[model samples]
Target chain A: MTKKLNVAVVGATGAVGSKMMEKLVERNFPIETIKFLASARSAGKTIEFNGTQYKIEEATPESFEGVDVALFSAGGSVSEVLAPEAAKRGAIVIDNTSHFRMDPEVPLVVPEVNRHVLKTIPKGIIANPNCSTIQMVAALQPIREKFGLTKIIVSTYQAVSGSGIAAIEELREQSAQWEAGKNVEANVLPVKSDVKHYPIARNVIPQIDKFTDNGFTYEEMKMINETKKIMEAPGMKVAATCVRVPVVSGHSESVYIEVEQETTVQEIFEVLKAAPGITLQDDITQQLYPMPIFAENEEATFVGRIRQDLDNKKGFHLWIVSDNLLKGAALNSIQIAEALLEDNIL
Target chain B: MTKKLNVAVVGATGAVGSKMMEKLVERNFPIETIKFLASARSAGKTIEFNGTQYKIEEATPESFEGVDVALFSAGGSVSEVLAPEAAKRGAIVIDNTSHFRMDPEVPLVVPEVNRHVLKTIPKGIIANPNCSTIQMVAALQPIREKFGLTKIIVSTYQAVSGSGIAAIEELREQSAQWEAGKNVEANVLPVKSDVKHYPIARNVIPQIDKFTDNGFTYEEMKMINETKKIMEAPGMKVAATCVRVPVVSGHSESVYIEVEQETTVQEIFEVLKAAPGITLQDDITQQLYPMPIFAENEEATFVGRIRQDLDNKKGFHLWIVSDNLLKGAALNSIQIAEALLEDNIL
Candidate 1:
C-alpha cells in the first residue's frame, strides 16, 4: 500500500522557496498534508495551494513536530539553526544552504548525478549543491562516467536571480531607469554588504561574491569545491571563473574539460542525449543551441556547442544552460524528496 | 619637420568609420585635407569635423588618387574589392577587415603589441585583428613577453555594436518589445542570413558567425587565428568561445593563459600596470574590477581579477575589457597609421 507523507517548506516567501512550493504542487507529490513555514515577518501571510488557503507559520523547532519531510531554502544561518532541529524532530531535512554542504556528515546530493546519497541520511539532513554547481555537474555526469573525466575549466554567465528576490527587483528597476535616461541606483548585486555596488544592467560583473584569500571569489570556490565533493572526484582538477550577467533566471556555462582518454564529439553527444535530466541541443545546421532566456522555467539542463579543442585532442568544450531557480535550487530539492520516496528510504 | 597628409576614410557613415573620423579629429592628426568617402547611397551627405562641413564622396578606385592614407572599415567584401585598388593609387591602406588579415602579404597589426609590423607593408595593406582578440592580446602582450606564453583559452561576452548599427537597432527595439510584453523579433544577431536568429535581449547567443568545417564559428576562428598572427606566435595554442551579450559597446573576456615559466599574481600585476594601453583595475579588498558598462567609452583595455591557477603553476586567469569601437576598431586603425608615420613607411 502507498503511504501519504506530511511535508513542510521553510523560507516559504523567498525567490527559491516560492518555486519549491510551486514545484511541489505542480509535480503533485503524494502529500497528505502541507505546511508553509517562514520567518516571523511573513508568518501571518496566507498562500494558496491545491485550491486551499494555508497560513504561513513561524519556523520554530515546534513547527516540525509532525512533519515527515522538510525542504529548506532559507539563508545559511536559518538552516544552521533550524535544519538540525527539524531533523531531530523525526523529519528528514533537505537543506538548500552552504552551511552543511561541506560538512562531512551531511551528504550533498544532486539526484541526477548522485542519488545513492539519499539512502543513508545518518544526520537526517541532505545538503543541496550550489546553483551553478548543480547544473554543471548534471551536464557532466554522463561524460564523466563514459570518458573518465580528469579536469574541468568553466566560466559561468550567471543570472541575477541567484542573489535573491531583491537583486532581481534591482535589475528590473535599474535597467528601466537607464532606459528612461534617469539616474540608476543599485543596492544589491555582486555582493550585498561589500561596501560597493555596481549597476548590472547590460553589464557583466566578474565578482559574484566576496573574494577568498587565494584570490578566487567565494562563489568560484563554491563551484570548485562543491563539484569535487558531489562528483566524489576529490583528485580531479577543477577551476572556475564566475561572472554575473544581466540575465533573470537561467545560468549558462562555457565548460572546457579534459578527459583521461581521447573521445570524439559524436560519442559525447550520444552519451549526454541518453543521460537523465539533460537535453541535447547541439545541431549546427538548424542553428539550434542553448540560451538562458529559453532555459527559464525548464527543469532539464540544456547542453550544446560541443566541439573538441583545437590543440588538445583530449579536451572538449560545451555550453550548458539551466534554470537556476528550478534545477539549481527548488526543483532539485523536490527531486531529492522524490528520490527518497522512490528508494523507500523515508 | 612633420609632413601634412591627405587622409580618406571609406564607409564614413558606418559605425566604425564614423568613430575613425571622431578619433582623427579628436587627436588633431597632422592632416592637410580630410575626405569622407562612402558608397553611392550616401555620397552627398555632409558631416562636420574641425568646425567645417565636408561633403562625402562616392568611394571608387579613383577616390584614392590624391590620398596619402586610406582607412577601411567597410565590410570584408568591400575591402576585398577596393583595398588593393586604393593601395595601387599611392595610398597606404590600413584594412580593418578579415578579408586580408590572414594573407601572407599582409601584416596583421595591433599598435600597442606589434606596431613594428607597420614598418613593411609588402601588399601596401596592414590588417587589423578582430575586436575581441585585440583587447585580449593587448592585455597579454606584456605578460607573454615577460613569461613566454604558450596557450590561451578565452570566452568572450561581446557587444551587439560589433555587428553594426543595424544590429544595435535590433537589440534596442527587441528589448523594448520584450519589456512591453510583446514577442521579441530577432533579425540580425548570431548571423543575420542564417536560417535561425536568436534574441539578444536578456540572453546570450553562442554563435557569432557561420560555422566552419571543424564546428567552430567563423568569429571564433578569427580570434584563434588572428591572435597567432598578430603575436607572431604561430605555435601558440589558442581556443575561443565567442558569445554575444546584451551590451551596447564594450567587450569583456574571461581569459585563461598558460605561460612557459611559473609566476605570481603580484608580478603579473606590476608588468601590466607599466604596460601601455592597459589599465589595472584589480583590487579585491575594495571590490574593484573591470566591467563592460564602465569600459564603454574608454580607450584603454581594462584588466583585473588576476590569479594563479590552483593546480597548474604555469596557468593564470584574467578578465579583460575594452570598448569594441575604440580600442577594437577605430582607435587601432588610427594607431596603425601613427606607427606608419612614425616609422617613415607612409
Candidate 2:
C-alpha cells in the first residue's frame, strides 16, 4: 500500500487556484486528505472534493502544520506575506507567484525541464515559472535539447483569463455592450486598470504588464528572465512581445528561433512529433495547426506551424499554443508536486 | 480659386475604399468630380459620401480618363492589372497594394515623411505605403527628422479588417457562436478561403498573409520594405511580426526604435506632438491611449504609451494604433491627393 499525502491549497477560490484543485483531482493524486484555504472573506466558503464537502479555511502558518505540500496562487503580495509563513510549518511550498521566482534561495522548477534541480531545492519553498514562460519552456525544452538553441523571438497573443476573473468579466461585459452599440467601458484587460480602459473584445492591446524602466513590460521581461532561469541558459538571447488579446483562456505565441545545429523543417517536425507532453498538429497541407479551442482543457502544450526561417537557414519559426491557466500555471505546478511525490521528496 | 481635380476611388466597396471616399469628402478634397469603381460583382452598388450617394462603376482603362487621381485598394492582383491601365490613361495612380510600391519607377508615398518625393511621381503612378507602415512612418518621420533613426523593430497587432470584408464577417459570426455556447465554424479570417478555418473568437492567428519563401508573411515583408521606401533609407534595419487578432478595425503596433542622435522621451513626445496628421494620446497615468474604437472615424495616426527603452539610452518604445482602413490605406491616399492639390501639382 502507498502512503497518501496531505495537501493544502491557498487561494483556492481564485482562477488558477481553482484550476489547480481540479487538476489535482483529475490527475488522481494519492491525497489522503485535502485542505482548501482562501482570504478571510472566503474562509467560510465550502467546496467539494472527492465526493465530500470541504470548508475553505483562512491560510496561515498554522494551516500547514501537518501538511506535506502547500500550493500558493493568491497574488504576489499575498504570497510575499503567507509563503514564508506556510514554509515555516514544515510543509514544502510550491509558490505560483513572482514573489520568489527570481530569488536565489528558491528554486524555480518546471518538472519536465528542471526536475533534477529539485534535489537542490533550497529550504522548503519552490517557485513555479510564470504562466507564459512555463508553457513556452515546456514546448521548447525538448527542441532545445535535441537541436541546441541559440536565439528566440516570440510574440504572444495572450488571453484575458491570464489576468484574472475580473478580466474575464470585463471582457464579457464590454463585449455585450459593444454588440448593443453602447460604449463599452473597459477597466481591465490590456493591463489591470490601464490609466484609460481600452476595449479588448475585438482588439489586441500591445502593452501587457506595465513597462519596466528598461522598456519591457514586467510580463515581457519575466518571459525573458524566466526562460533563462528555466532553461538554465543565461547566455541565450530571447526577445519577446507580449500582447493581450480577446482570448478567454489560452495563449498563442508565434516563436521564431535560430539554433546552432543544422536542421530542416521536416527534421524539426519529426523531433516535436515525439516530444513528451507535447502534441504536434502541424499539417499545413490540410490547414491543420494547434488552436486555442482544442487546447482549452488540455494539459499538454501544442506546437504547430513549424517551419524554417526564410532568410536564416539556421533559424526556425514555430507557433506554440497552450491553455495559459493549465499548462501555463496550474497544471505545471501540479506536475511539479507530482514530481516531488515521484522522487519521494515530499 | 483652387482648380478642382477629378478623382476616382477604385475598389470603392471595400473597407479601405469606402474610407477613402469619406476622407476625401471630410477633408473637402478639391474634387471637380468623383468616380467610384469596383469589381463586376459590386459595380452597380452605391455608397453615401458626405450625405450624397454615388453609384459604383466597373473598373476599366476608360474609367481613369480625365481623372486627375486614382486610388487603388482592390488588392495587389487587381492593382497589378488595373493600375497601369489607369496610369496609362493619364491618371496619377496612388496604389494601396504591394503591386507597385517597390517598382523602380513607382514612388512609395507617405506625405508627412516623403511628400517631397511626389515631385518625381514618374509613370503617373504613386504607391501608397502599407497601412501599418503608413501610420508607423507618420509617427516616426517626426522623430527621424528630429533625431535620425538607425534601427527599428516592430511587432504588429493587426486588425482582421485588413484582410477584407469576409474576415470581419467571420469574426462576428464565430464570436456569436462562441458566446452562444456553440462550436465556432470559421470559414474566413486567419486568411480567407484557406483550406482549414480555426476559431479566432479568442485566439490569435500569427499568419497574417501567406508565408513567403523567406518565412516572413507577405504582410510583414511589406511593412519592412515599404518603411524603407517611404523613409528613403533603404538601409534602415527593420524587422516586423504581423499578427491577426479578433480586432475589427484598428491595427496596433509595438514599435521599438533607436535613433542616431541623443534623445529622451520628452524630446520624442514633443516632436510627435507637432507632427502633421498625428495625434499623441499617450498618458500612461490617465490610461489614455490610441485605441481602435475611439480611432474608428478619425484620420490622424494616434501614437501613445511612449517610453524610453531601458537597455538603450538612444532607443524608444511606443504603442502606435490607427484605423487600418483610414490612416493605413484610404486616408493616407486621400492625404497624398490633398498634398498634390495643395502643391498645385494636380
Say which candidate scores most in lDDT: 1
Q: Clashing residue pairs, candidate 1? A: none
Write model 1 residue lDDT over A1-346, tens digit each, in one string: 1778999999878999989988988998889898999899988999887788999999899999999999998899999999999999999999998999999888899998889877678889999999999999999999999989999999999999999999999988887887888988988988897889999888899998899999999899999999999999899999999999888889999999999888899999999989999999998888889999999999999999999999999999999999999999999999999988889987
Error of 1 at A283 (Å): 0.9
DockQ of all models, two decimals each: 0.85, 0.40
Please write out the lDDT profile of model 2 over residues B155-230, one tens digit for every residue.
Answer: 7888888888888888888877877888889777677756556767777776776666655667888988888888
Mind giving the per-residue lDDT tens digits that candidate 2 earns over A145-258? 988998776778888889999999888888788777898788876777545567788777767877665556788899989899988898897777787888889898878777
List fnat, each candidate: 0.79, 0.39
Return the top candidate by DockQ: 1
TM-score of every candidate relative to the true structure: 0.99, 0.92
Task: Compute the DockQ of candidate 2.
Answer: 0.40
